[model samples]
Target chain A: MTTTLDMTALDLRQVNTRLQAAARAQANEDYVITNPRGSHAMACGLDGPLGVTIKGSTGYYCAGMNKEATITVEGSAGPGVAENMMSGTVTIHGDASQYAGATGHGGLLNIKGNASSRCGISMKGIDIVVHGNIGHMSAFMAQKGNLVVLGDAGDALGDSIYEARLFVRGSVKSLGADCIEKEMRPEHLETLAALLDKAGADARPEEFRRYGSARKLYNFNIDHADEY
Target chain B: MCGIVGLFLKKDDLRPRLGDMLTDMLITMTDRGPDSAGIAIYGDAEAGRTKITVQSEDPARAFADLDAAVSEALGQPVTLTVVDTHAVLIVPDDRVAEATALLEDRGLRVMGSGASMEIYKEVGLPRDVAARFGLRQMGGSHGIGHTRMATESAVTTMGAHPFSTAPDQCLVHNGSLSNHNQMRRRLAKKGVFTRSENDTEVGAAYISSRIAEGASLGEALDGTIRDLDGFFTFVMGTRTGFGVVRDPIACKPAVMAETDDYVAFASEYRAFADLPGIEAARVWEPEPATVYFWER
Candidate 1:
């Protein structure tokens, strides 16, 4: 069954409580939230295979710490959207603000519009795909993940990156410290094609470049001490 | 963190509702800052008259017969309007400097002075500050407000935002400047000074100094990206309009919305949710290190 939750009538706490209860019970129901109006932290910490949809724009930290719920925002999302997710799919039909998917263990974050600065800072094991451009300092100190951007990237892409793989189809303003463009092998192409397909992106995987950590800063080197 | 909101009316029909709209936007951002709140409104200007907004700890004593004293000193008619601890004194345009000096001599803190801008700020909640100033009833072409979290300054009336270092111009900032003290000394050498120890005041002074040097609003804001250190999302107001700029890093959150009638800027999208025709307005986050301004 489909459940309609009106934010104007119910407070955020109550809405979250109901959604959490349903997810905990593994109800596997569909929820539609209306009148979000840029409130923060909505539909967070869902653990069941439930379907959730937010009708409008949301504020900071929306859909954070998701486990197994598929949440979709019909409008834009604020900073840190889908942050720290474990396993699930969180799709934003509009732009996302800063740090859209920071420090996630696992999940798929699909953004149809642009994402601002720090798009995937310190990400561990999440997969993020953006259909538009991303801002500066994206994937900073990221440990493990896959970030695919179909459009241009701002300055300092993948600074201090480790393990994580970055695929950008457009120009990068500047590569971050210890990060460089590498040849896109067949496996990388296959991975990008899968992610792009899963995210419903229309672009071909062949027209992209891969960037990753150069591993120079992995250890404390005395020779590069002056750069710090 | 601090919250900044600005509204510039593109249509005259929306001018009367500027304060009402801006008040709602500011109050909605009360959670971002609870230490102090301030607003600078660009209202009507009478010919040959200038407004000097002043604040006093003891309004009853400091404002009593104040206009009479200033009128006698300037040999002209001066009008005084008091709202809570703040008051606006209207004097002839030529005597703005003399009037400001006299007010300072009387222990009154000059918030700002301009032909059309009247700044009112206090160390209280945004709702209370707006109510005390009757912000909803006031009309303006453009206005800017700040809900301060007090990162780089004390929680005092003099330290509140919308700092107007030059006439018909004011600025509100959402982030702290890392090098304000150094900039303050540099501006002090050039005779540009600030009354409070607030870093935002130094930013305002910097912009005002640039404008004083014949820089346009866009050029002055561009200079901030080049010279000012640290993160900032500034919305500045002038006699004709307002401008917005963010640091190159843009760590500070800023959202702007525009329609046929107005252009609104805030630290978040929620502030713009209540604006008229907001659903249809073209909303977008401004690019970092870019200056965007609108003037009628």
Candidate 2:
């Protein structure tokens, strides 16, 4: 069974209890948390097929630790929204605060406007798509997964960039360690297009650029000794 | 503890008085290391011949020793002129090691070392260090710098990082050593000279010595992944570009920011805040026992 909670009469605590109760009753049940103004931690840590729809703005840590649920935020969200989320779809109509979807393990995060710094910081398997400009240090030492930025990137775009696919459509002020601009091949173009589509952005994939490691500094050389 | 700053020619086109950038950056970080400063301004590669700047506690005596050592090692009667606390030596690329070893062997403090090729560092802060060294006058394509909060080892020029860990390799470390003593003993057996008691020096030595034995920088880094005992975040720059790694389990903090202006990684995000436009900045923490590699 699906449960709809009108957050106008209920606080985040009640909404959470209802979502948990719904999860206990039906594993596949979805919860729609509605409120005109954004609140904080509206729907978090819900597991199974529990879908969450927040109709307005929300405070920090909304949809955190989520598993398998599809969460949609009608308006903006505060810091650490969807942080360390396991598996789910978190869609935000407006912008997000710092550390959005940080250290996420899996699932997809779609930010419509833009995200602040430490967005998807230390992401593992999750795929994040930012339609607008992103803040500084987008992906520092990210181990795996893909981050698609449709707009210009901030300073230190991928400082000490790891094995993550970073695609930026607009100007990239600077690039991080081992990150170099590469020729966008047909295969890469297709991949970026899909990411944009998933993020609901209007940008064409060709407008962006691809960056990764050059692999030259991976090894040391005496002939290149003077080079360091 | 000290702060370091340098400016590499990010722009492809050559400009006049490029050393001024290093001077500017070094000035910004002067409060980080104020004891003594040095700079070695490198010329364009096509121009040929690398200029080296070095500093020492015993200024006049160190220069004399450096001059005699260079003459003896190269057998070419090299000229060493003392400019304040620094001694300027212009030489070809390959001769750097024999020259450095000879200088160190003769008891020269060797505060900061560099060439038209790359800059090497030891303990000191930014501004006065830059003014004393005059870095804003050189030019190059790529550069790497460091800021240190020294722990466990005596803070001195030698204890400072960006050590010439190998022939042309230099490294900066941010962590404590758990098994520094053992590692030092192991490297010593292989004829790698152990300079200071600092664990980071061992790491630099390990990387350089491994590369000297034909190991790739990445492979050497991976090699140390198993052998070295510590929680650390480290960055090393070679003529090749830049390379960084974190311990399998993070024992320290490191952040990377990429923007339209430049890609910068530091121990804190407060470092990259002012850049103009960017999609976003993200911070990540390495998992326990995870390794990452980046080259430029």
Instruction: List per-model TM-scores for chain B.
Output: 0.99, 0.74
In the range A125-196, model 2's lDDT, one tens digit per residue, is 778898887776777666667788888886667666667778888888777666778888998889788877
Error of 1 at B110 (Å): 0.9
Worst 10 residues of 2 chain A by lDDT: A33-42
TM-score of chain B of 2: 0.74
Off by over 4 Å in 2: A1-228, B1-10, B14-53, B64-84, B92-102, B110-124, B257-263, B273-296
Tens digit per residue, CA lDDT, model 1, B21-137:
999999999999888899999999999999999999999999999989998999988999998999999998999999999999999999999999999999999999999889999
State the lDDT of candidate 2 residue by residue for B50-145, as single tens digits. Answer: 445566677866776676667667876565657556576766666766776666676665443444344434445655455455455555554555
Clashing residue pairs in candidate 1 are none
Candidate 2 C-alpha error for residue B8, in Å: 6.0
**Which 10 consecutive positions of candidate 2 chain B have the poorest summed lDDT?**
B270-279
Task: Give stretches of model 1 more than 4 Å off.
Answer: A225-228
Overall lDDT per candidate, in order of appearance: 0.93, 0.65
What TM-score should be assigned to candidate 1? 0.97
